[model samples]
Target: MSSHSKSLGEFDLIERFFKTGANSLRTTADSAIALGIGDDCALIRPPADEEIAITSDMLVEGRHFFAGADPELLGRKALAVNLSDLAAMGAKPLGFTLAIALPMVDKIWLEAFSKGLFAASYDYSCPLIGGDTTAGPLTISITAFGSSPTGKAIRRSGAKAGDDIWVSGTVGDARLALAALRHELNLPNADLQNIAHRMHQPTPRIELGIQLRGIASAALDVSDGLLGDLRHILKQSQVDAEIQLNQLPKSITLQKQGIGIQNQFAASGGDDYELCFTAPSTQREKIHTISKILNLPLTLIGKILPKKDVEVRIHLLDASGIELSNSEAAPFLNSFDHFAS
Candidate 1:
């Protein structure tokens, strides 16, 4: 495969593999894309009354995935994470551009990767309009475009004191998968596969985000650890929060773990891709209705509080709703830091 791919020029590679996939993504007559691949630049026409929401994410080999990881899964995840960003903003996906760097053009690898990429594109109605493929270390960077009603896009600064803090779907399973893969933990094969799927293929809550437009005050998807990502909201909103450690929604697989493991992973694990949002307490019933309508679990874990002295504190609480001391909360505060040694 490598020998055959080596004979193919870069332009030929693009035309043979990625171009067809991009062309097929223009299945909708009302697609925002005016032109796709083989152009100097892709054209788009967004509705005048709507605002464009764009996000980009880069996945580097070794840093983001294991060497020799399934290219198909990698392809899906590269796009899924970007879509998750759109979901965070309560926007509907329109299209995307992919810029990929490859060590070599392996036809087998390209086939699987393109399959996965187009699957997500078709599922989310996010067409691939343009991209650049170059020779380098394997890396995928995707920039996704979405649209939302003007003035209706959710922001991190809108969370107010007295708002209820909520999270959609479960957390921590992905961390458990990572731990097991790194040999930091041991697990049954069944459990490992289940949790690993969560780590590799995350579902972006696009519909939920769209429905929460007027209801949620502030929202973001959990890619970094929940606490760390939620801090962005706190800092922007200038508010504090108290979260019940036990109230964090977890998969049954995660719940079976020890208390310390549960707390650590659920609070600080990255790549959950679930939604963490804030809404007024008065909308609790409406939130519940949305949850049922979407058939997704929405857990209320905390409340926004008035910021004191410009310090945005995240008070950790026990199952009984008693606040824990700094000493007791210290262990659960550690989150993934890219530059940390």
Candidate 2:
């Protein structure tokens, strides 16, 4: 042992106390980490002829996630959520950094979390390039990086008044999962288990995002609920949409549960991890075709409209094939105002 060795102390709290950055066991992408650990700054090279896309997030205990959450899943989810942002920009996966704070070193928890981190990181081919660790409330802040050919990246400002809007996957899974966790709703054991999985393991649609680079006029991830996230695109594109209520992808179980459509669970409840995008009406078939090839379902839910602000028109049909709207039937979206205390 070296003379510089310091006692870890009981509870290993001393070492954890001094470990003021990402733990040493983190998978370090040594090649790109030209100046790792103890360095003032880090440097990396971008892909040739491509522009870099960057996104970050802070996963805080009690705020962003639960305190009793499994550490391994937390590690994976922290990365997945950030990558979803990069995916929305139609960028290829590159790498990420983690800054984790923990109250104490629990080997079991750390091992499980490290396993999850490495599993997902390697699966996505995104290496853990670098980061710092510290002693504080349990929190994991991740910063992800990606690159796309210059001028090929997707943005939230390309929708036109006549464009069609689409979404991948269903909505309300995460919020429903949270509800299950809280026992606010007594669902079947199998159902609750499924929801829990979605909450813990969100799959970011990176490949689909890449494929939609040229096809989608605008795109964003449905993280903060469909309505809230869609509003971001609407505002950026300076357009409005009349999304059909019945066209939304609701889980069959969610439907059988008789969860009222008025809840707009597909619209107001968020964290679905789906991609909502817009394309010319002519491209609708193209979108579905690619979806078939990719084995990912993409649904055409509505059309962009000429309006001053974003307004959703739910359930647009009658016996005579005329548009219809009722206070109880048309559960419009109010993402910004929903669940605001």
**Best by the TM-score measure:** 1
Q: Name the weakest run of 10 consecutive residues (lDDT summed) in model 2.
A: 1-10
* Candidate 2 to truth, TM: 0.83
Off by over 4 Å in 2: 1-39, 259-263, 309-332, 336-341
Poorly placed runs, candidate 1 (over 4 Å) = 1-8, 338-341
CA lDDT for candidate 2: 0.72
Q: What is the lDDT, from 0 to 100, of the residue 273 in candidate 2?
A: 79
Candidate 1, TM-score vs. the true structure? 0.95
Q: What is candidate 1's local distance difference test score?
A: 0.87
lDDT string, candidate 2, 68-95, tens digits: 8887898788888888898898997777
Residue 191 alpha-carbon offset, candidate 2, angstroms = 1.4
